[model samples]
Target: MSIGNVSAVLVHGAWADGSSWSKVVERLKAHGINAVAAPLPLTSLHDDVAALNRTLERIEGPVVLAGHAYAGAVIGSTRADSVKALVYVAALAPAEGETVGDVFYRGEAHPLAPKLSPDQHGLIWLPEEAFAAAFAQNATAQELTVLGAVQRPISVSCIGEPVERPLWTDRPSWFLSAEQDRMISPDTQHFMAQRMNARVHSHQVDHTPIVTAPDVVTDVIVEAVQAVSTR
Candidate 1:
């Protein structure tokens, strides 16, 4: 499978929807790379993984699975045979028995990071103002406003659950390091990427590079697609 011969499935993290990968999807389609964004309910890890699996089931050929933020853990749970590669974009790749929160709160929070608390519905939401301040500082004012408006709330149960064996252990993987990320620390990203022995690509981007730097993000995805296509 050549890069052009494979498809890609993109998974977005908490507080965002498939639209987060809109620009990346457009660029991939332009490259003749069929790509789709999986819609996560953000209700539970099992639910999100099942959602991704449904998307994977629809594709016929080799796939380059990509995840951002929380979806990294979602993708990790996949054992789909069609998946040829893994691309983690500032994603959390928690090992066996480790919950997302375990890795997330491993270190002191970044000073500019927003304080999070679940709402009455047991969902964690990014404050409307958080998009501009910490979530996506590289995004335009208009983008920040829209992000806040269209954000999805993540369930608390999802973060506290442990992940299955990470798919990266069996599949070739690539990692993107966000040097200026305010959500997940740069050090944590590095550690996760290094731990997975992934092909690491570091950038001085914000937490939401798929929105702030789509071209850069697309380039990395293309790299993964091309790599997996050869297999």
Candidate 2:
């Protein structure tokens, strides 16, 4: 099962866009790896999967599709055959017929997630205060400010929608668990990793590992690329 050369498509989580992977992307490029961040719509499962699939359709070679947080569900549902491996970066990594909301509710609540209230349009967005404390605890004041300013609203519907496919079961998988994550518990991440039989890596960082430890995150992704390419 040795794939020759493959591109890596990085997907951002809730409240984030492709820029979240800027530092990691630079590191990957420095290693002569072909990588790009797929800017997820984060509006709904259907739209997000469509966006990811479109990105996959454009890639010219086998791909290692990496997803964080909500995008994990996106990748699981939209398992493009072009994806040779799936990488979870402090991500949800739900199974088929499961939703991101189901994963969170099944596990104990993280201490920092603000009490959420959905809008009429069914979108769930963290309050501004929760942004700094829960989502970007490891980030500096300036980074937190930038995150708050650019945060995208996610539809609540996306959380409850079941993943139509389970990519991890079909492809080689990797998981990066954030030991200090306050958004999603490390225990829950471990459970998912074990269930998927993923090669696991741990970092004493926050939920946004790409922001706090971009180099290490890039290394983990590069390992997945190598594993897939040399398979």
Q: lDDT (CA) for every model shown? A: 0.91, 0.85
| CA shift of 16, model 1, Å | 0.4
List candidate 1 stretches off by more than 4 Å.
none
- Model 2, 120-223: lDDT tens digits are 88777779988778887888898888888888889887787777668788788999999988888889999999999999999898889888789879888889
- Per-candidate TM-scores read 0.98, 0.95
User: What would the TM-score be for candidate 1 when compared with the true structure?
Assistant: 0.98
Please tell me which predicted candidate would have the highest lDDT against the true structure: 1
Report the lDDT tens digits of candidate 1 across residue range 45-135.
9899999999899998899999999998999999999998899998899998899898888767889899999999999999877888888
Question: How does candidate 2 fare on TM-score?
Answer: 0.95
Worst 10 residues of 1 by lDDT: 1-10
